[model samples]
Target: MAAPLFLLAPPRSYTSLVNAMLGQHPQCFGLPELCLFNVDTLVDLWRGSAAEISENGPMARHGLLRAVAEIYCGEQSTATVNMALRWASVREHWTTGQVFQEIVDKIHPLVAVEKSPSYTISVKRMRAMLDTFPDARFLHLVRHPVAQAKSLLAINDGAFTIKVNAFEIGEDYALMEPQIAWHDINLNILDFLDKVPPAQQMRMRGEDIMAQPEQRLAEIARWAGLRDDAEAVDQMMHPERSPFACFGPINALFGNDPNFLAGPTFRPHTPKIPPLSKPVPWRDDGKGLHPEVVQLANEFGYV
Candidate 1:
């Protein structure tokens, strides 16, 4: 079996679109965010999160549901989702790694490409993935901290920050800080990548992919040991062709970002990169980025 390719990044860093783009490769099967490693066993996904942060809600299972529905039954419908539920029930006692392997095996020959932003929330879950697939390749997807934090605040009223507990606790006012989440999550990815052999991993900037997809995609294809010829590159150019690129049935509605689902098409254009020292637009107090954020963003090649 070919080792699966996993994209690692914080949420809203163009992961959904990129995952689809990569999946469209003729030799690859782009998967929705399975989020299987968030728990130890298949059953834990249904039990929901007991931690301060609730990780295993209905939305968390949506990706797996859509995947099972489409893979097993060849379609996603309320009926298929029910079948998927029964499918999961029988393996409730199995470890998440085992369940993922089943899905990977089911889709053998083609590489499985997946990215769940939640996986970066904990090193243990990532370690579990490595333990399960020793040959798995990791692509540490990155975006400018400034751009990423702003995108986070734009969605769900910045609720993602709460998931990472990214906040500034002052003597008086406790403030939600999205940059903290950005810095720390990337930090977590870096620390985890330290354990992985350098050859099994690569880093790419999301903005670069957006700016020049054909070039970047071809570069990635070469790195993954896939076909980098014109035919393969052309296939990757249309991420919309991937089955999981669109919204699933009503029952298994989403396994990807809704924005991407609404418009899964890829448009190539250069992204704006803001100066790291300026005060973030989301803040009113005129405080600039934390020193650590600047350091990290610089490390990511964001000036």
Candidate 2:
């Protein structure tokens, strides 16, 4: 089986766009966030882990259900999704790695490309992926801490940060800090990537890709041993062409970001890079990124 490509990043790091774009390649199959690695066994996804902050709900299962439906039944209708649920139920006793290997095998030669930002919450989750597919390649997608933190707060008041226990405990209350999430999650990815061969892992700035997608996309295609011809480049430009780009059926309405689902089309525009020293706008007291965040961002080649 051809090992899949996994995009590792914290939420709000342009992972959805990049994952879909790469998946759009003629030789690849983009999948929604299966989130399988977050657990040890397939049933653990339903049983839930000890992390209280982690996202859990029927909705969390929707992505896997939708992907299974689309891959096996060639569609994502409610009926197909129900079939997917049944399919998952049949394999509930299997390890997550086993279930994931099945999906990769079913979609062999297409180069399955996937990203589940939640995987960055812990190094163990990522290690689970490597354990499953030793040959899997990793893309460590980075965004400026300032921009990433801002985007995180904008989404459900940084619920993801809380999920990852990115907080500042005070005498009176605990405050959610997106920058902590930004630094810690990237650290987790970096620590995990340390175990991967340099040739099997790569790092790219999300801003760079936004500014020059054609060049960057082609570079990634070449790195993945995929065709970098004009045709492949053109295909990568249209992430909306991916089956999981949009919302799924009413039952499985989201296997991806809702904001992305609302508008999955690729629009070329350079994302603004904020100065690390400036005060963050989200804070009432006008605080800037944490010192640790700045240091890690610099390590990531950010100014």
Q: Give the per-residue lDDT of model 2 (tens digit) for 163-263.
A: 77788887997778888888888989999999999989999999999999999999998888899999999999999999999999988888788899999
Per-residue lDDT of model 1, residues 1-303, tens digit only: 989999999998989988999998999999999989999999999887434232777778889999998889988889999999999999999999999999999989999999999999999989999999999999999998888998998888888898788999999999999999999999999999999998899999999999988899998888889999999988998999888888888877888888999899888999999899899998899998999999988888888
Model 1 TM-score (2 dp): 0.97
Q: After superposition, how far is residue 216 of candidate 1 from its true place, in Å?
A: 0.7
Specify the highest-lDDT model's number.
Answer: 1
What does the lDDT read for residue 80 in candidate 2?
Answer: 99
TM-score for predicted model 2 compared with the true structure: 0.96
TM-scores for all predictions: 0.97, 0.96
Off by over 4 Å in 1: 49-54
Model 2, global lDDT: 0.89
* Residue pairs in candidate 2 whose N, alpha carbon or C atoms collide under 3 angstroms: none
Candidate 2 stretches with Cα past 4 Å from truth are 49-56, 170-174
